[model samples]
Target: MRLVKTEKTGRSVHWPTIAALAFLVPVLLTALGDAKGAEPEHRPLMSFEYDPSSEVDVELVLAVDISQSMDTDEQEVQRAGYIAALTSEEFLNAVQYGPTGRIAVIYMEWGGVDEHFLVADWTVIKDAATARIFAGQIAEAPLRQVQRTSITSALTKSVSLVNENAYQGLRRVIDISGDGPNNQGGSVTKVRDHLVSAGITINGLPLMMKTSTNTWQAMLNLDHYYEDCVIGGPGSFAIPVKSKDGFADAIRMKLVMEIAGLTFDRPSFHPVADRRPVRCDLFD
Candidate 1:
């Protein structure tokens, strides 16, 4: 039996009501490498100029959902997909294809308005080894779940992560993955507009998995909700995952596009860009 859960141990902290919230790639090496979990694989390290101040092609914050609505199986799938995407040869190639041949990235999982956890700290990915390390770091960490969905908190935390990052970037992106509408946080649209206006692009990976949750509470046409409400700014886009089988591929595709910065005329391997401008009042 599925028991309902809440993120707060005491009371939930709603950011939107307070009015002052904070904020915050790619390439393709086409290697279809094996995926690993959140554990570090013992491997030889490659030495390079380890400069803290460096320019990256993109600075990305991966903000994912870990609400109670996302069950253990779903969470495992989500986690594995990210691990696969980051470790893939295609993702590494995209990283090298960048003008700087490197990018700074962070991973975060969010649920309730007060529940945002940092899984991976800011790390630079320029080559295969570093990328492997990044993936390993996430693989080794324990999976966490919170109750409720606060996309606003996800966005707000993403902005802060990117802004405080150690490296500068030619572009900034917040790649959000979620399975439901905002039910426990401040206005999703309101915060999205605020972030987009600040010159940060937001992309989305909307999970359209069928669930037996109450229809009145479960979102209808969640892809549309994400397109119209959750993502925005220049070169922003979203890709919806319709099935468990497609989750990993969707993540890989989204990561490749974001890393490539494919505004238009994308290659056959990449998905087409969406020209729709996001609006703040979409869910209302």
Candidate 2:
């Protein structure tokens, strides 16, 4: 059974009414990285002079969904996949290739409009040892499920988290992973557009392992929804996970791309560039 609790904000947003609200035009984003298909693993690490002002190369918020729609088994797979990716050789190598060789990360879970929980606080990971410690904390943390899906609330909280954090980075990114669309809280497209305007990049991981026609929340072509409505800003992209086994690989690839600020030309990687510009009324 899914748990229900009062929202901490003490406010409720009607989804239908909120959806009707006008959306701001999104700012065009410049693509990051070069045309050469340079994989992070193959890139050579270069020495960087440490600037006290910029502590890390990127500040990343890993916002994962924990709504009742995701079963316990699926949740475990999701959690495990992150752990594996963080400790993977590719991720560690990518960190070293960065100018700072360090990145700040926050792992958070969200469900309803008010159900954003911080599983792991902002931690700087520069090497394998620090990465292991961060991964260990994630592995030890308990998982809980809340009712409803609210990508809007999650993005709102992510922006706030980035603003509140002390570490300054060359890039700010929110890596959002979810299985459903926003059926609660305010309009996701509005919040996404706001983030893009503020120069915050948003990437997405659309979990499609359990897509079904019977489930109301299990949306089809979720990757399209993410690309067209959820993600924005420079170098924004969405990678859909069609099977349970693809989670780790997809996550590792996304992290490497974000940390190294590079994009691969592989077919599996979907960059939101050179396509139609994102519109506010996508879902409607």
Candidate 3:
């Protein structure tokens, strides 16, 4: 992965090269058909080597923010955090203790409705080597798009991706990490409610750090906005990483909680005064 300095923001971020995979003509045809609003294509006859029926306990999908606000430095930290978590001994232990000793994840970057890119899809990490390969692939993929933050789109697409997996896991989760609130697309509250009701847990990593003294107040304001509208479902909670340095710790903690399926006592950190529950009715 090459770290690139953002010209506009003067921040350095790691940019990874894309890996080329052999394309099957039939698969391409199915994708084309789906794009044309035809009937949904049937599942592929081929499958990954990993055994999904071995009772895998958890399936985690990470939805990361690659919006314009996240400068190169911040994005690098975010990417590194996930890489470290996936390769960590603790995470592996959690996976092994489960029935299948496996965890499948889809790495996606999202900004707005039209800006979701699947960097990696449903890679089952059963060993250290597999985990490293997944991480390396993520590190090499370039940032696909940049727009406004749309937490709703990320959550919606994530739910769809997880359902597409054939793994029979005990738990399903969508880990969403963002440094800003939803300012694009439809209402986030509506999407949040719909996903939560579908029995998918939604956890959040909200970056509250300020890049400049002038942006501190604005960042703090947005943090509160996230606490209200962006997190929900069983064991759902938002952990604030006050700065880039805290990214690793926050990510580690979130991963452990997800693997263990731990529940939170309450939503403790409220950054805004309108500490009301996120209600879709308000927007309607």
Best by lDDT: 2
**Per-residue accuracy of model 1 over 182-251 as CA lDDT, tens digit each:** 8756688889999998889999888877644546334456676787788888888888887788999999
Q: TM-scores of all models?
A: 0.74, 0.75, 0.74
- The whole-model lDDT of each prediction reads 0.81, 0.84, 0.77
lDDT of 3: 0.77
Largest TM-score belongs to which candidate?
2
Evaluated at residue 181, the lDDT of candidate 2 is: 79
Write model 3 residue lDDT over 211-280, tens digit each, in one string: 4553743634545556678778877877877877788878888887888787666555753454655443
lDDT of 3 at 102: 79
All-Cα superposition RMSD per candidate: 28.6, 27.7, 26.8
Candidate 2 lDDT over residue span 8-110, tens digit each: 9756666554444533212112123332444556767798776585588999999999999888998999999999999999999999998988999999999
Error of 1 at 261 (Å): 0.2
